[model samples]
Target: MQRGLRSFIIIWIGQFASLFGSALTRFAITVWIYQKTGSATALTTGGFFAMAPTFLLLPIGGALADRLDRKKVMIAADLTGGLCTVFMLSLYLNGNLQIWHIYLTNVILSAVEAFQYPAFTAATAMIVPKEHFARVSGMRDLAGNASRIFAPLLAGALLAILDLSQFMIIDLITLSIALLTLTMVAIPKPTQTEESKRAQANLLQDVTYGFKFIWKRPSLVILQSILLTLNFLYTMGNMLIPAMILSRTNNNELILGSVQAVMSAGALAGGLLISIWGGSKRKIKTVLMAQVLTAIVGRVWFGLGYDTLSWLLPSFFVFFFIPISNGSTAAIWLAKTPPDVQGRVFATRRFAAQFCLPLSALLAGPLAERVFEPAMMPGGALASLFGNVLHTGVGAGISLMMLLSGIIGAAVSLLVYVIPLVWRVDEILPDHIAEPSSLIPEKTVDSDVGVKAPEGAASPAD
Candidate 1:
């Protein structure tokens, strides 16, 4: 293997372990919270707390990533996250663990992630060659999908045999593994440009520079707008999947779990495929087409299917395309944005795309419970209108919601694709050229400042 890709694989192994451990802890805590309170609202409230801080703090985190050593920033984030787990363990051992303590810990960890994500993303661009951006992104998605597939099952099995405190120790161990891997690798840093030098002058400007960067580029603005709209619409329907399944299946957890497992498996397969194929040459087209397919095949089928097989098929298809679309999008930005400014640019892109998630979370339940549910009930106001197509019943309203989201999402993606700016993004935005390393000698390279590779070392693409 090439040296750069080899180094990245080592890091990926540690990160995969860490991600699995975190997923296990999160699942265990979610079960514990629900069992103790028996209130979905209380459980959801903790999630809101966890997400709120990350949204608010991401720009600041991005700024820090740019100004600091990316490696050190990641190490600090891992250490803080590990400490949060330890704090929770201590509380549980002392019999003082409350729902509030979990919420507090969630908030802290979310904040740490705000910093960690940007640094890691920026570092990946630094070390990997441009040709392999999509492949690496697919690999990252693979880790996440693998965690989703296994974490819940493993956590449940362990919980049956061990206490939550003991389970949490595993998380700490994973964090140490991540830290060790990070310490061993060297990440290249971007050579400073005039734009970066000016950005460094003011903290506030650094935070906002990402926004300005995108705004100046119409193609990027359109891309972000498309993603933002899709996220808002998708989240509105996506969050209701569990409710729809449970209600339709008469609260059968087995069917629900089976469907979820299939979905994760599909995503895992897609990620693995993309990692090998590296996506299509026209990444922008790949991204848009994937969304269209996801909406038409996945969401539309989900709303129409009533049986277990029906749900499983659509769920798998939806998740499978998601990784392809996401990997393509990451590759687009990685190539277009200069490495020195990627931390901020990428963070802003994420913040904009996901800004509506919490809003959708708030609205989806109320819309389903009050408006859609009532309207879809037999002989209800809108039942006669949509009844013939949707089959008015327990989850029929949510089915309608899903159907509508899919239609709208598909239409929006197509509409955006037709726009010249978005359709021709690749042609409009030129790729950033990598600076030659001859200017900075290997003997003088500093880890904090950044290193291009040691002399004679091969990069990922090579």
Candidate 2:
């Protein structure tokens, strides 16, 4: 293997370890907070603080990724995140840890991740061969799915034997591994284009350039819209799945865990398949069709099913297509956007796609508790009409919500797919060529404006 590819592999391994460690910490902290406070609001509040910063800071992080050494940026992010963990550990050991402290730590770590994410994403595009972009995206998804699959189990096991402080030391160790790997490899910088040079001239302009880049391409805007809509619908249903299952099963924790594990396994399996197959050549079609399947099979079928077997099978299919959809989308962006501007562009894409997640989360609970559940109860309004179909009761309202989200999501996806611009994105947009670059460029450009696609560059659509 070439040196750059080798470096990417090494970095990926380290990042996988780091991601697992972070997941473990998050799981443990969430459990701890719930145990101490016994308040669902507290748990949700912690999550909100953790996620809010990433959305707010992503554009700034993207700008910095373009301007700074990507390796150093990643290392700094890791170090900062590690220190936050360490701080929490110290507070726990001193018996002074509080819910507020955990929430504060989550905020800081999330802010750091805002920077870490874009740097790693842009660096992958920089170091890996363009042909391998889809494969690399699959690998990235695999790491995340693996973390989600195993972290809760591992953290629960460790929490049985160890306190929170001791558990956190493991996270510190993983962060060190990530730092070591980052130091060992050299990441190449993208060669400057005229647009980048001009964008870099003004700090404000640099920060906004990612948004402009996507806006200039009508296809990308529509794609973003589809993602945003799907994300909102998906998150709303996903947030309630556990409640739906637990309520129906009389708070069967084991069953809930089993369902979650199966979902993660499905995602992991999808990632593994994509890694091997590198997805279909028709990347946009893969993205849209996957959404349709995810909504129809995962959400719609899942909602219609009332038993364990019914839920488990559809749950697996729902998560299985998630990685495929996400991997294809990543491959699309990696191919279409120029390397010099990817940090900003990709960050912008992430911000747009995920902006509705928190909103959906916030809304799902109330809609279920106040509106859906009440309406689905026996003799409640609309209960008589849909009762025969969904079986009016505690969790039935959430199930109806899931069913509606799926129908709407599938309809939207199919609608978007038929639009000539969205489905034909791969044909309309040109892939950016990955060129060999020295460790340091002779001159650097900061702006991403008006960089023409490289000549003879192949489109993934072809």
Per-residue alpha-carbon lDDT of model 1 for 1-462, expressed as tens digits? 655677678777777777777767776776676557644345546656766677688888888888888877777777787888899999999999999999888789778867877887877776667888888888877777776677765665677687889879988887677666665666457888666776676889899988888899988888888888877777667666666776778655456556766777777887788789888898889888878987899778888776687787787776778778888888989888888988898788778777666676667777887889889999988899989887888778888888888899899988975699998998888988654223335554345321111100000000
Q: Which residue pairs collide, candidate 1?
A: none
Please give the lDDT score for candidate 1.
0.74
lDDT (CA) per prediction = 0.74, 0.73
Off by over 4 Å in 2: 34-41, 156-160, 242-253, 305-307, 377-394, 436-462
Off by over 4 Å in 1: 33-43, 94-96, 156-163, 246-254, 377-379, 382-396, 435-462
lDDT of 2 by residue, 1-462 (tens): 765566667666776777777767766776676557644346556656766788799888888888887766766776787789889999999999999998799789778867877777887776667777777677777666677677765666677677788778888887777666655556556878765776774667778999998899999888888878887877767766756776788655456556766777777787787777877898888888778888898779888877688787877776787767777888889888778887788778888777666667677777888888899999988699878888888888988988898899889888985699998998998877666322334244221111001000000111
Highest TM-score: which candidate? 1
User: RMSD per prediction, one decimal?
Assistant: 5.3, 5.9
Taking all chains together, each candidate's TM-score versus the true structure is 0.88, 0.87
